[model samples]
Target chain A: MIETDWLWGLLGGLMIGGAAALYLLVNGRVMGASGIIGGLVDGSARDQWAERLAFLAGLVGVPALAVLLIGGAETHLSGNPAVLILGGLLVGLGTRMANGCTSGHGVCGISRLSLRGIVATVFYILVGGIVMVLARHVLGWI
Target chain B: MARSLFSALAGAIFGLGLLVSGMTDTTRVQGWLDVFGDWDPTLAFVMGGALIPMAIAWRVAARRRVAVLGNPLPLTHERVVDAKLVIGSSLFGAGWGLAGLCPGPALASLGWGGWGGLLFLLAMLVGMVAAPAAKARIDRITQAA
Candidate 1:
């Protein structure tokens, strides 16, 4: 199963990268998911609201259409409200503060070899792994 | 007009990729991060696969002064590895490990993630709204230290 999973991952990754490539080559912008949505949340994208909204509409709408067409998708998100809320808050605030996330720093940034992108990726992955170990192994909460 | 259209197209493709690649699955994401336990290496392929086209895109972008649509390229010039970067990334990582959802998947998963996903999205928005002030405070404290 893991063997076949890699194929799907790779194919999907190519699509993702292709999208980012198109966004850059045509839209002249890095397709950082957090930055795109963050601009809307913070109202900094007021000047280009249409563009940002369009992007988000697609980001949200496509998945929705897929769910309807192919049946529902499962997230397997934790049921704990505490975990959900805390994680959500941190992801939002932290992405905003750092100006990137997995798509931004991990994919776009690293591909370009941006030092900030590389550093941010390292910190997040390292810290994320540590937290997972502590939460799952030590606390048994997650 | 073209910009918005292209943006939407790109975003749609990205969302599709997330769904198809299983990045929208919390268990898969958590499994990837769970290196100490039963680890999943599927995400590495995703990351590596994503890098290939993007790297080429960067090279193509370098040769062109303007985007295909004639917009000035919005290339980032940020190079500083400041405290905000470190602290913010650490926090984001913690949240990712806890929930197994980052910004993109969190949004993409909303259609099927049900109430839990909605809750996470709402909380994420609130946190995003409050982030600037938090950063300001962190800056002050760091400066003082």
Candidate 2:
């Protein structure tokens, strides 16, 4: 299962990279989903709303429609509503504050070797790891 | 016209990649974070796979001043490494660990994740909307300090 996981991960990652590359090559925009969506909502991206909307239509619409076709997208979300809300707030606020997220900073930023991207990724992962340890083990909250 | 079509196509491919890579699965993501426990290194492979093509693409992009659709390339990046970047990323990371859902997985899994995904997404949007105010307050505090 682990070995196959790697294979799928690699293939899927390639697809993601390809998608980012295509967005860059064709659209000339960094393929950061959070940035794309955030821009639209924050009033900062109003000028490019059409393109952003189109991108999201595919980002959201595809998966939405795909489950109907392929039928599998199992997610193990937490049952606790509080945790979900807190987590959502943190993700939204933090990604916006930092100007990126996993896709923007992790994939696109690191690929370009941007210092901000690298630093953001490292901090987030480290903090995330620490939080995971505390929440899952020490506190047993998650 | 053409740009919108391409953007949608890119989004579709990206969503497909997330689904294929098992990133949409919270267990897989949590497993990767559980380094001390039963760690799953699959996420690393996904990152590796994603980096290669993206790295190559960046190189290709470096040569062109504009995109195929003739829009100016958006390649310039923030060079500063400040409190906002560190604190924001750290917060985001903590939140991600708390709930195995980041923007990509959270949005991508909406169809199947149901109410949970919907609620999370909604809350996240609220956070996004509220971020500017928070940042302004933080900036004022920092400046005073």
Candidate 3:
């Protein structure tokens, strides 16, 4: 059966991609999602703060807007809020250690054929795979 | 001039493809490969869906002269494969599995009242800030070598 998830994935992809591209085009920066948020350290990091907030706000607001404008999808965060919290901490650390988030490194960096980026991306992907395995296979945590 | 713009255009499209493939969803992503044997098979389709659009976008972008922005897209790069790669990868994996989040989606998920996304974002900055010092040490050793 055709899945609504697919459509969500498609349109959502386009919105994110479009924003990243536009952000880069206008600002001439890597569309690293983390960097944008980091800029939120102050009221707004000049253009950095403004755009970052907007981008992040857009990330949340847009999706909500989309669901409101169009419809809602089945996406929901499961597991414990504690899990999500712990998970976020690890990811924050990992992205820093890796020097780029998925959007910055995984999408922007890899596309540029950056060797360091590629290597780092591989690390991210492999680790993601391993974690998924351990979470279910070993830890028995969904 | 045109080339760089076009390249950016292509990259943006590729990213969108990744998003569409459901790669941005932390739970769905972990769900597909959950090794405890609850293996969610949907991730493969996400991968496939991404590849499809990616291939097509590249082919079209490749044929263009000056990108839509009137300049060549800078495709310059640096490829470093070293000890850092191994260590960095290991850390990234550990963090990801533990958090069930990655850089992209974690940031994206912030919209959904993602407390996890916020926490991850915080740590990610700490990590990036530290990367320079780590790189400096690596540089020192190499110089001594």
Chain A superposition TM-score per model: 0.96, 0.96, 0.80
What is the fnat score of candidate 2?
0.84
Which residue runs of candidate 3 sit more than 4 Å off their true CA positions?
A1-15, A39-47, A68-82, B1-25, B35-75, B82-85, B114-145
Could you give candidate 3's per-residue lDDT for residues A25-122 as a string of tens digits? 43444567655554444223464454455455545454544435654333344446666655655555445445566666655665555677667767
lDDT of 2 by residue, B21-135 (tens): 9998888888889888799898899999999999999999889979999988876878988778888999899889988888987887888897888888998898899888888
Rank order (by lDDT, best first): 1, 2, 3
Listed per model in order, the count of residue pairs whose N, CA or C atoms clash below 3 Å is: 0, 0, 23
| Model 3 docking tier (incorrect/acceptable/medium/high) | acceptable
Chain B TM per candidate, please? Answer: 0.95, 0.96, 0.69
Q: Quote model 3's TM-score for chain B.
A: 0.69
lDDT of 3 by residue, B45-137 (tens): 443333343334334444652344444533344466666555656676666666656665554445543454565566665665555467567
lDDT of 2 at B137: 81
TM-scores for all predictions: 0.97, 0.97, 0.67
- Grade the docking of candidate 2: high
Q: Candidate 3 at residue A15, lDDT?
A: 49
